[model samples]
Target: MDPIEAAIEEIKSLPHDQSFTFSEIARKHGVVRSTLIRRYKAITEPRTVKAVKQHALTPDQEIELVAWINRQNEKRLPPLRRLVQNWASEIAGKPIGESWVGGFLDRHQDELIAKWTKGMDRDRHQADSWHKYKRYFDFWHAKMEQYSIEPRHMYNMDEKGLMLGITNRSQRVFTRRMWEKGELRSVLRDGSREWGDYPCHYL
Candidate 1:
C-alpha cells in the first residue's frame, strides 16, 4: 500500500479518545499530512486506480482488445497501429486521437511491443512445419546408422541468400512473451527470384 493510504488506515484504527492527530500519523508514515487527511476522508482514490477510469477503453474492453491481439499474433498476422486504433475506436464508441495508440502501447508495454517484421518466403514458411522437420531428422539419423558414419565425418551446410530489391518493413504489435522467446519476427511475403547465395560448411 501507499504510505498515505497506510497512514490513513492507521488513523482510522485509532481509539476515539486517542491522542494521535493526522499530522502525527502522517509524520510517522512519512506521508504528507493534507494527502493523508484527504485519503482518510475518502475524498479521492489512488492515482493509478483513478487513471484507469480516465482511459478511452474500460478495463474490460482493454482486456478484450489484448485477447484479440494475442489471437492475431498466434496466427502470425499481428495487427498494425492503424488497425488497433480502429478497433479501439469501435470499442470505445468514439474515434481515438493520433497519439492514443502510442499511449496505449506504453500502458501495455509489459504485455505487448511494436516491432518491425522480417519478411519470409511463403513457400519456405509453409514447408518449415514441425512434422516435416521431424521426418527429415529421423531419415538422416537412420541413414547415419546404416552407413556407420562417425560424428567427426559429418558436415553441416548453411545457405544464406540476399534478395536484390527494396522490401518494406511494417511495424506490428506482438506479445512480449513471444518476442522474448524469439518467435515474433517473421511474416510471410511473396516469393523472391532476384537473389545471390553464399554457402558455408562446418564439420
Candidate 2:
C-alpha cells in the first residue's frame, strides 16, 4: 500500500486516546506495519525487542516451516495453515516476509515429503504341508486286527541327525548408497567355518 495514503488513514482513525494496533492498520488500510513505521519514524515500539535480520530464518523458524508444510499437505482446516504461518513468523524472532512463509515448501521441495505413513514391508507367514497318513493308519489298524498285535509289541527304528555334517549357506544383501571404503565382501559357504578357529580350544 502507498505510504502517503496510509499515513492519512491512520491520522483520521486517531481518537483523543492514541492507542491502536499495527494489525488494525494492515487489515483496514492494506498497509504493512513497516511502511507506517517508516512514515512515522518517531512511533514508539510497543514491545522491547532486539532488531533482527529480516527474511532470514532462525533455527526454530526452520522447524516451524517444516511443520507448516506437513500441515498444509495434510488437508486440514484453513485456520491450521494460518496458525502455522503465525507460529513460523513469531519463531523467526522477527517479522517474516509473506513470500518466505508461502514459498517454504517450494524452495525446500526436495526435503518435504507427502507420506501418509512410514513405509513398511508386510510379511505373510504361510504354513508348510502336513500329512494325515490316512493310508498308513488304515494299514496298521488292519495288521493289528489280523494278527491280534498290540502297539506295545511294535519296534521303532529311525536314523537320528543323519544330516549333521550337512550345512546351509546364506548370503547377505546390502543396498545402501555408500558402504565402508574397503573390500567387497561375499558370503562364503558354511563348510568354510570351523569350530577349531576359536582361540580357546578344548580337547
Candidate 3:
C-alpha cells in the first residue's frame, strides 16, 4: 500500500474520541501531521476535488515532460534550463520565468539532478553515438571481468567550474583518505550517509 494510504488507514483506525489529534496520528504512522491532515480532509471531503492545490503541469503533462527530457538525454543532447523554460512558456501560452523552472525542478528533483556543465567542455562537444558507447562499454566490461575489478576500486574526479555570474547555493566539502586493505570504506555526501550518493559515487 502507498504510505499515504496506509497513513489514512491509521487515521481511520484511531479512536473516534477527539482526544487524539492529527499530531497523535502522525506520530503513530511516522508521517507529518500536515500530511495526515491533508489525507484526512481528502477522505472526508472527496467531493471537494477542485479545492485541492496542484502544480502548473498536470500529472500527465509532467510525465510527458519527463519522457521528453529522457529522450533528449538518450541522444546526448541535454536541453538547457532556458530551453526548458521556453518550452514551459509555450505549453502554458504565456511567458514563464526562472521561478517556475525552479519550482518544477524542486518537485522533480528525485527524478532529475541539476548539474553544472561548462559550455566549452569538450567532453560533451559531440553527441554520443549509441554504437560508439556500446562498443566502449563492452570492452570496458570485458576488461573489468578479466581483472576482477570492482567499482569500489574506481574513483572519478571532475572539476566543476564556479559560475561567476550566479549566486552560490551552498558550499560542498570533500575529504579523502586512503583505506587499509580489508578495511571497509565509507563515503557520505552532505556530511551524512545518503543512499542517493551511491549512484553518483559509482558513476
Candidate 4:
C-alpha cells in the first residue's frame, strides 16, 4: 500500500476522542495536510484513481498498446506519431486529440521514447540477422588466420555516395530500453535510387 494510504488508515483507526489534530497526523505520516483532510473526509479520491477514471485507455488497454509498440519496434517498423494516434483511437473507440499522444508518451516515458530514425537500406536490413553476421565474421576470422594478419596491418577504407538535399529521416516511437541498448534507431527503406545527382567532391 502507498504510505499515504497507510497513514490514512491509521488516522481512521484512531479513537474519536483522540487529541491528535489532523495536521499533526499528516506531519507524522509525511503527507500534505490538505490532501490528508480531503481523503479522510472522502471529499476526493486518489490521484491515480481519478486519472484512471478520466483516461481514454484503461490500464489493461494501455499495457496492450505498450506491448504492441515494442513488437513493432522489434520488427524494425517503429510507428510514427500519427500512426500511434490512429491506433490509440482504435483502442479507445474514438478519435483522440493531437495532444493525447504526447500525454500518453509522458505517462509511459520509462518504457517508450520518440526519436528521429536513421534510414537504412532494405538490403542492409535484410542482412542484419545473427546467422548472417556470425557466418561473415567466421569467414573473416578464417581468412585472417590463413594470412597471419595482424591488427596493425589492417587499413579500413569506405566509400559512400550522398544525394544533396535529400533526407529519409522520420520521427518514430521505440522502446526506451531497446534504444538505450543501441538496438533501435534505423528505419528500413529502398536505397536503389537517389533524388539528385549532385556531386560532392572530397577535399
Best by TM-score: 1
Ranking by TM-score: 1, 4, 3, 2
| Better-scoring candidate (lDDT), 1 or 2 | 1
lDDT for each residue of candidate 3 in 1-203, tens digit (9 for 90 to 100): 65556778876786788466777667766777886687678644333344333356666666677666656544334455676777776766778777777777766665544444323222332323566668967987877787787968754432222223333233211111111221112221112222223543222
RMSD of each: 12.4, 21.1, 16.4, 13.5
Candidate 1 regions with alpha-carbon error over 4 angstroms: 16-19, 117-169, 180-184, 188-203
Per-model lDDT = 0.73, 0.43, 0.52, 0.74
lDDT sort, best first: 4, 1, 3, 2
Candidate 4: give its CA RMSD in angstroms: 13.5
Per-residue lDDT for 105 in model 4? 95
List where candidate 3 sits over 4 angstroms from the true fold. Answer: 1-54, 119-203
lDDT of 3 at 67: 66
In model 3, what is the error at residue 21, expressed in angstroms? 19
lDDT of 4 by residue, 64-109 (tens): 9999999987765678888898999999999888688888999999
Put down candidate 2 lDDT per residue, 110-170, tens digits, no spaces: 5442212111112101111123345656877887888888888764322111123233322
Instruction: Answer with 2 or 3, whichever has the higher lDDT.
Output: 3
> lDDT by residue for model 1 over 1-203, one digit each (tens)?
88887777787788889887887888899988888888778798899879988899987998888889999877665787788899999999999885888888898899999876456565555655678778977987877788777777875431222232434555678888887787755432323332223442222
